[model samples]
Target: MSEAVLPMSATPVATSRAPTDWNGEAMRRRIALRYAAERRFRLLGLCAVLISAGFLAFLLISMGANGARGFMSTQIKLPVDFPRSPIMIDPAMLSTNPDQVLANANLPQVIESSAQAAFGKDGDDYISSGAVAALRKAIIADPGILTRKVTITVPASAGIDLAAKSDGSEADEAAVVKLEQARALSTGFNGGFLTSSDGTDPTVVGIWGALKGSLLTMAITLALSFPIGVFAALYLEEYAPRNRWTDIIEVSINNLAAVPSIIFGLLGLAIFLNMMHLPRSAPLVGGMTLALMTMPVIVIAGRNAIKAVPPSIRDAALGIGASPIQVVFHHVLPLALPGILTGTIIGMARALGETAPLLMIGMRAFVASPPGGITDPATVLPVQIFLWSDEVGKGFIEKTSAAIIVLLIFLLTMNSIAIYLRNKFEKKW
Candidate 1:
């Protein structure tokens, strides 16, 4: 068996004429060349895909690198605790006069006293002199601080905060030295950035109030835009005839979507704020402006979504003796809900981030107090970021960037929802 070596039953002779054309050997070589070419094509496509992915990754990394730093903020934990012997803020001492308020007690002195009482001797160095101003602002904001000792969490000063979070490696020797003193002061967040209202001071400005305003604006957008848009879409797709007027309306809608957002802002101010004299910076006004801007988009999207639904569905509903309205509402609308919602969410989110119109209405101005309702003066996230980014402070840079990140996160989440709905509910008839 080891010695056995077998060949074909009939041994073939070697050919000198390059083997006959289209012989097995030649065919095999051609097939191999085709495979090699295909492999090259596939490899090129893969390289292009990888390059595209890399660019996308770079973009996201840039956003996260800048935005993630915002989350690492300066926070100040107060030594304040519940006091057994509370210095009753006699209601009589609640006066608006700065001198009378600071009369016998400077804001620093009062807060210092509170701190000593709370953390004892250990709390003396724990507080900063600037912390006194924060306390003053708090007291002025709420005169009731005279009644009870409360623990508050505030943001630390920018320099102090940056030092705590940074490893000192990123900063130059000079900047690092500048931050040394801030680091030496009792370590912790120097607060005001979290709970306070908008201000030029990066160390003092807060996002808490703006968060509420955006929520209200979105609420108004969803409440008003969805129903109106859907109805308009249904009418156009199902009931409206293809007439000259309808053609004009459709053209106008396309034009509206193309109109500059700022133009809408200007129109909003003219109609809602100046003419109607509604609250200037109210979420209601903002929502209305955005809704008007979004209506055409919704109508267009809604019409498309509705049109995409098979007419068979409508015919089937009508065959059962359903009225036109009933058939549409019950059968057609249900089928198009996913697309409708996707458009609505997209429009609402876009409206939420819009700032030019909000600025036209006066949301750029500072309000020491938060809004009480949708009609109250409000500032949204985009406008808030714009305000902060203009401030001439290193700290505000991170803060502005952080706000932008928050906005991006929100946008990404909304898009994800829309895509999810689209893919999940997509139908192939």
Candidate 2:
């Protein structure tokens, strides 16, 4: 029955001829249409790039807008007249009406009152009343304000702070008084931003204490981190044996880098401040904490830099009668210098911006004194910024912005230097 059904097997039909293009342009046009029809991927890629660029520009613009005023300052101009016999001769006499006496005194009056005063009668017209207050503060700090009758034209609020502004204009809407206090502050040039201190009143606080603390912290971090990092890197990359213990140690170091920075803060609090009895809020303690956090990173980067150098270079140096240390230092270190330096600057930038660890170690303290040394109580920039941001005042808004700007500038400068160092001296093998 199957053989009978198979008798109907049909012959295969011939396929039709395929179409051919006669014109080259037409063929190209057809291919172009095909590609265009499949172009969704390219369009998506372009959209992604444009969106990312737009987001970046937006961030930069926002930071600039908020932080720009930090570069400018408000000033209060006051006329002063230093008058002779201005000394009250008693602290009570000066204390009874300090502001009143200051208000009544003009620049010429104050200057003329000082034995060291040197100014024409019109000098009072050119000085800031706010500046005179600062001088009075200095006098109060010293035991001399009671007997000193300096008719100082103190700086007033709303006067441009030159250090805080690039353009030095306080008349702009951004710097204008938004609150009664600011309006009150608008009386003359407070000594730019540098003379200010951290306080609940943004009008009265400055970042100087914070600035100095950052410097001291970074200095100690550099001093402690660099040598130790380099030494550890050299041992691990050049001399250490690769065993289970070594592997474990390497893993631990890597894990250390991943640890939350706040953990390091707790560690600093326990080990440095509590256990070791180190002073709280000291840069030394902060630096130690930060360096502990940074060490793992530095070691890793250093090893990578060393590893990037070819073994052949080492062999050549040894063949030329160089000792192991000389070969590594003279040849490998030079080649690795750029990467090492880049890592260092990056670490410094990280440390500079660190807040959590510093917070634990007492750097979160409201330190008003300029840092005396490594062991002195101090407030780093981020801590200062944090403190200022929490302050309740219309002026703190700008002060916070200003502090952020300063922090960003330092970070940017450090990064720029890193880039410069990397590019300027890097050599190809």
TM-score of 2: 0.70
Cα misplacement distance, residue 170 of candidate 1 (Å): 14
Deviating ranges (above 4 Å) for candidate 1: 1-56, 74-105, 109-130, 133-155, 164-194, 412-429
Q: Which residue pairs come into collision in candidate 1?
A: 75-189, 76-189, 89-146, 154-191, 155-190, 155-191, 155-192, 156-189, 156-190, 156-191
Pick by lDDT: which candidate is best?
1
Query: Whole-model lDDT for model 1 versus the true structure?
Result: 0.71
What ranges in model 2 sit over 4 Å off? 1-52, 71-191, 427-429
Please provide, for model 1 over 196-312, each residue's C-alpha lDDT reduced to its tens digit, 9 standing for 90 to 100: 667655655667667678778877877788789899889888899999998998898889988989999999899998899998889899888888878877888898889888988
Q: Give lDDT per model, in order.
A: 0.71, 0.69
